[model samples]
Target chain A: MVLKHIRNLKNRFSSIVSRIFRKKRDIRIGLYGPVNSGKTTLANRICMDWLGEEMGSASVVPHETREIQTKEKVQIKSNGKSLTFNLVDTPGIATKIDFEDFLKFGLKKTEAKSRAKEATRGVIEAIKWLDRMDMVLVVLDSTKDPINQVNITILGNLDARNIPLLIVSNKADVRKSSTTKIRNAFPGYDVIGISAKTGQNMKDLYGSLLKKL
Target chain B: MNLKIKFIPYEKMKMDSFSDILRDVKENTIILIDAKLKPEEESEIIEKTMESVSEKFSGIELSSIDFAGEEEMNNFERFKNIIIERIIGKKRGMTIIGPAKIIHKIKKNPKELLLYM
Candidate 1:
């Protein structure tokens, strides 16, 4: 009876010590990419998986996210290990933002100009916030050619800063998706294909994200 | 040189100005204090502008002209005319001024003006 009591006390003490020693620091994970690359969709998927909520609204219009969106303290469980991180969903990054582009999308002149200005500022703000990121997920549309100036510039900046990153080839659910193109373009970075819209191959995404962490 | 000259392409800066006159200078820079602003907000905006500049040029120093004497204003006018005359790639230019330390750097390394945007 005494041995049994001692074993129980020892187990309780070890569990308490383990909890205290566990790494509870909230890692900051930033989602970065160009406009309409499904960044928000992937962010929503991750949020829903862990927090049961969505981060921001996604739309077919370019630069829908005109500001930086953040969701904090998201705990993701993968393969029996749990990781907690603050998710930072940044506005789309673009080299040039012209108001006339929005006119084709059926927006009024005033609204288009305002959106262009806001999106331009958002690009700058996203660049400024790069210094605060612990890890980054560069989302790319698998349907599009991975060879683009925006992708190169973003990756160059990340490489210059030596930030830990993963390339997520999103929208693999589409029949025309070709993640191999992305993998070939960026051979150095880890690329994982997943359908953020339909939650396809999410297990692989979670595992890869944990590896990044 | 009383003015520490730093050249900035207008597209490189990224902030919405609260001042009325400076609003039209979007995608360009004034480099001088030509707009009217409250003294309290003046210092804040000046610092913010300089901070944005520092993000481009790490070691550069920035300064503002509170009251441009006649000669200084005349010099500014001539420089502005020259910029308007031969604008490269139609790129707008703005400059910030400082004292001895900055003047020395500009004089020593003029090529630093063409750093990446």
Candidate 2:
């Protein structure tokens, strides 16, 4: 009986040591795309689906995300290991450097210029932070033409950096928006058309993300 | 084929103004708009215009062409080739080209077919 008890004790001790010594893996993911392409909506969906609570707000305004928003300590089970994610939502990439445009959004001229400058800095930050991310979700507006400068620029940057990308085409419920056009625009990238509002194709998105992870 | 086209530039009026342009484009014709606005602004405009257009032309089918900036000119051939390779023989529909630079290129090219928007 004493020998059996000692054997159990050894097993418990080794399990504790292994648990203590196990390496922890954390993945950084950036939700990036043009403004109003539903980055916040996608981020909120991810937080809600994975964490059982919404973490971000969706807005119809352009440049709704003025700063970098982060949701940390998100855990996912992949490859039989517990993987943590630091999901970041960044300001949308603008194609032009127009400060006057911000004035239409109700900001004063100086404030608009400052916001534009902040947005420019945010774009640089988003691009530079590409190296730190394990995977990127380049969101696109499905209800419009896919050959956008911002989307192309971001895609080019990701290509240059050799980062794996998953193109999330939002607003799939819009009838005239063609996902096929978007797919054709980006020749050799993994693209998925999903509606963040209706949760269409979100399961597939999750599955694709899991595969990438 | 009946083709309609619309063009909006970055330096011109606000991107939101393009929604009216999209509305003016004939049904079943391609609607193209400049994508050179600030990323967030462009996205917002596109989203709003798309929502309106979809509601107005519920059953009509349309094609759209978004233009990348001048920095992507070298890559233009690839885009044109893709359109030609994917669209030329299979579809004989209307082509709507937008973004000033792309429209300028299209106007210069041999495909000089004109329509109204």
Candidate 3:
């Protein structure tokens, strides 16, 4: 049972108040998406740009960050614009976490099992933390299909909670990157194309993030 | 329609009876249900699926209508295969039962109730 915390409710209330008053300071902005979609990469980019440091390490293996990592008070100054908020880089959300999937990547049985367990817990923790977020950056891999079960479920959860969101189409540097498909998959929502690794179109992302706030 | 079956251990379950878990199951949906008995005992499932049977699932009280239909009464051989192939004689396991599309729909809805065998 991944129930919402009372602390989340209080934070949401204050966040609603902050948005109405146009106050961006200390706002909880979460990065949510599927595994290996470059959420940690994007988080690191933002942190590196403003704070001169990275929040956590990224891995080629799936579910590298199984716990929520936060970099607070990241004051972004870009394109002659600025906004200050807490960057909550969360674990990737997966509908299914099979140890066998990890085993295919050459992990030992025991290590695979423990990683699966931790990833499962991380998913639940991510959902519980959603209530505390005033806004979310729904990062998606532009090279993959956007209509996947994980993406739909993430969007559904965010919609059910009525949270404000901006879809960050990550990995646009890849040859097959297509933000149009993502826009079609989720119409009426703002989608921005950016290469978190190469820093392509990052200025547009900054402008969009400010609009979402 | 393709289907998948998985096993769930009742020892760690919070429910006392199969009906307790059955109450949260939605109608006309493909689902994994416990099917460990011999094919002959397919009759036993009849008792669990009776329209009049009611029980608690995860604390919410409901009835069998929430899970199955009389149509299931005719699928003994299918259930038998699920038992032999998936359960492999394990005293406890689950069988996927329903239209492939509905089952996929259930799987996609992350908020849907799942004993998730």
Candidate 4:
């Protein structure tokens, strides 16, 4: 009878351990930036490294991402805790153009105007959603000058809302890139230099995000 | 000295007039036109805007120069000369081109201009 009780206790303990290991915690992270700033590349890299597959493709065309794309069920281990993340990749924000401007891209004047209006609204929606995010990653192109109107506007809005942000200086492997300039442009903010193509400094990026979260 | 710099966007300007606006600007004050306008258009608008102030400050001597495409060194020289000759000596001020390249050019001389960015 004592031997039978010991075997039953071992089975119960194994069941409890399996239940705990099977459970997953959800964490939502938003990726945001201006047009052509490499938000998609970062998202893809994160997914590939952590999830073992690319979440999406990266394009050179401006506003290639017309809508928000999300990759869910990504499991990441941080601080000895297993957490699942729903990575949200958003469309690029650009100046609103009129119907005539859209027609230049081969759309009907009315259609172009409507699309432009939607694009404008999309940007506002994405920005407003920042308030609901657990964390935000603001990707900046290191090759460009740090003083851009769009960047300043985005940074100001994020700062005003007091949202926790990580400035990811993308394209670090490119020649003539100045990550220092980017860090200086926005003071007192956490900035990381990462090359998504070569996966350089990505582990550090993940570690920083885990720490912040 | 308290220098008030008012940056008026180009889209907001009415009557394309600047002279009447400059009449109210205090001496040693900086008027920054924070607009993405063409160089020639900005030059013409600035001249017409500060015409009244130029005449009133005849004793102060207002000398204006337009900075279109000068390099960093040349731009700094232009600004330094304007401050000494037009602003201090004449007691009247002149309007430089927009975008504030003068400030940026001067910043390069320092080891780190990141603090200001």
Candidate 5:
């Protein structure tokens, strides 16, 4: 128990030191979440809104993003305030990956196995990059239940690292989506409901980003 | 197939460096911890699981339920639980971790964890 507190203190100290040193470096805002939670869609929306280009492809299939994709020099202005930062789109994090699951999506056996392997690597990469993020936007599907181990672990790690984050309750355009449920699940955090597909409530997101960073 | 369930105290988990836990998990054992693992510990376990992932061993299904906020506790009970947790440096909860192959899913509710095989 003492060791746990010591580890937490060490994490806080390292977070502070990193923040102090990162002032001169490029700010990296990462999009992270569970599998198929619309992270890449949000990343693409942000890029298209500000840079007039898309960052990455969004797909119905999970783990479409098998590597970390970054778009540099994204500048957004909202309410007369502008901020420029690098947007990093990370592959979805999952605890288990089975090739048979991909087969259910109509993928060939070989392709499914290959994708599963790459996804495992991608999960490792995303975890490793958690320490490098200046801030994170935890994208979650508002239509699904928010109380899960993956969400808890992600939020917990961010809290331990002292990294600023905003819980993005995405898929707000869906009829069954409920941001209130998400807020209830994770209290005491900034949560915004948005639809990347329809460009809904993006201005508020930008304003929040400008204010937070 | 026979199933093995190991009950491990939080202190022994820390002392054993989680190596034993991981090995038992790979050998098809379900692990039940007396306390909810810290977030850092969970992340460390995930990292280790990824490193150990193979064609035979995929990963784990993990879920935890803490008494705080899960049930309607009186203010006094809540306060006592908080104080006890603060003094012990461990949350009053339980964690169940099993190999993903054996445990297909572990659905978490506010008060209980439903394991699917």
Candidate 6:
């Protein structure tokens, strides 16, 4: 217990020191969540709205993004205020990756196994990049229950690291989507509902990001 | 296959290296910790699990419940719980971690956990 406290204090001290001495770099805003939670979709939306280009492709298959995709110098203007940052789209994090699950999606056995390997590596990469995020947008599928282990762990780790964050309840266009449930589940955080597919409530998302940072 | 469940006290877990725990988990053992793991501890476990992932051992399914944090409490009650946890050196709850191959999903209800095998 004492060691845990000491470790936390050390991390806090180092974070403070880093903030004090850190030179001017592009503010990195990262998109992170569980697999198939629409992280890439939201990333594409943000990039398209700001940089007039899409960041990456979105897919129904899990772990479609197997690498870290970054779009630099994405500038968004709201209320006459402008903010430019490097937008990072990370592969979704997951605890399990059974190749058999992919077989249901009509992938060949060899292809599924290969994809599983890459997905595991992607999960590791996403975990490794958590420290680099200046701010994180935790994109969650609003149609699903939000009180899962993946969501809790991500939120808890970010809070422990003292990183600025905002929760995005994506897929709000779905009839079953419920932002109220998400808001209720995580009471202390700011959450905005948006459909990354149809670009619903994106203005509110941008405005919220500006206020958060 | 015979199922094995190991219950370890939080203090003992802190004393032992997590690799020892992971070794048991790799051998198809389910671990029950006396208290909810802190976020950093959970992250550390995840990192270690990723390093050990292979054809045989894919990964682990981990879930923790903080009984105190889950409840709606008045400020005084919450403060009292916090003090108690501080003195106990652990949170007031349990955590279950098992191989993902064995435990497909551990669903979280508000107050109880339902494991899907």
Best by TM-score: 6
After superposition, which runs of candidate 5 have C-alpha atoms over 4 Å from their true positions?
A1-16, B70-83
Off by over 4 Å in 3: A1-25, B1-29, B32-117
Each candidate's B-chain TM-score, in sequence, is 0.23, 0.34, 0.30, 0.34, 0.89, 0.95
Q: Across residues A1-213, which tens digit of lDDT does each residue of candidate 2 receive?
A: 355356547754664554345334456788989778999898888788789887677776466676788899877554455557888888786533345666787879887766666665665566545556667999999887776445765776666555678999899988887788888777678889899888898888877777876
Q: Clash pairs of candidate 5?
A: none
> What TM-score would candidate 4 get against the native?
0.54
Query: Could you give candidate 6's per-residue lDDT for residues A1-213 as a string of tens digits?
Result: 577568768866877776555446779899999999999999999888877888888889888998999999999988888888999999998877777778889999899888888888888899878877889999999999999888998999899878899999999999999999999999989999999999999999999999988
As for lDDT, the candidate ahead, 5 or 6, is: 5
As a whole number from 0 to 100, the lDDT of residue B20 in candidate 3 is: 38
**Interface RMSD after interface superposition, model 1:** 16.7
DockQ, all candidates in order = 0.02, 0.02, 0.03, 0.02, 0.57, 0.57
Q: Which candidate order results from sorting by DockQ in descending order?
A: 6, 5, 3, 1, 2, 4
Docking tier of model 3: it is: incorrect
lDDT leader:
5
The TM-score that candidate 2 achieves is: 0.56
Query: Which pairs clash inside model 1?
Result: none
* Cα lDDT computed for each candidate against the true fold: 0.64, 0.60, 0.65, 0.58, 0.89, 0.88
TM-scores of the candidates in the order shown: 0.59, 0.56, 0.62, 0.54, 0.90, 0.92
- TM-score of the A chain in candidate 3: the value is 0.87
The DockQ-derived docking category for candidate 2 is: incorrect
- Work out how many backbone clashes candidate 2 has: 2
Residue A33 accuracy (lDDT) in model 3: 94
Segments of candidate 2 deviating more than 4 angstroms: A1-25, A76-83, A108-111, B1-117
Residue A210 in candidate 3 has what lDDT? 80
**TM-score comparison, 1 vs 5, better candidate:** 5
* Per-residue C-alpha lDDT of model 1 across residues B1-117, encoded as one tens digit per residue: 133223433233223342321332232432433321222233333333323322122112222222222123466776775575355322222234322122222221111232222
